[model samples]
Target: MPFIKLEGGKIDKEKKERLISEFTRIASETLGIPEEAFVVLIKENEMDNWGTGGKVLSKILAERGNK
Candidate 1:
């Protein structure tokens, strides 16, 4: 059995769903385990609480036109 924990800033429901599905597919194939034997956890944080290169994720996304 495998437990997957994904940590990131806020994201839409559609993207989250896709991520979970993709992760399950890859993990199941790579580990040769059934998809039902895996557990996936998505942990979201506030923009201010997540950062990269000394800058907050919100600011980076805003500067990039919110992607």
Candidate 2:
């Protein structure tokens, strides 16, 4: 079984579905794994709970000029 975990990001339901579809396609084409054998887990966190360089994620994104 192949397990794919996607964490530390905010994603909508539509995007999540698209990710799953892409993963399945890649696994089947590149890894030769059946879609049924692949498992994907997505975890989302608030900006306050994730950070880098002593700055909160919201702050980091702001500093990088990404809204």
Name the runs in model 2 displaced over 4 angstroms.
none
lDDT of 1 by residue, 3-66 (tens): 9989987879999999999999999999999999989999999988878899998899889998
- State the lDDT of candidate 2 residue by residue for 1-67, as single tens digits: 8998888678989999999899888988898878999988888888888877888988898888985
Q: Candidate 1: lDDT over CA atoms?
A: 0.91
Off by over 4 Å in 1: 52-56, 59-67
In order, the Cα lDDT scores of the candidates are: 0.91, 0.87
Minimal lDDT window, size 10, model 1: 58-67
TM-score of each: 0.75, 0.84
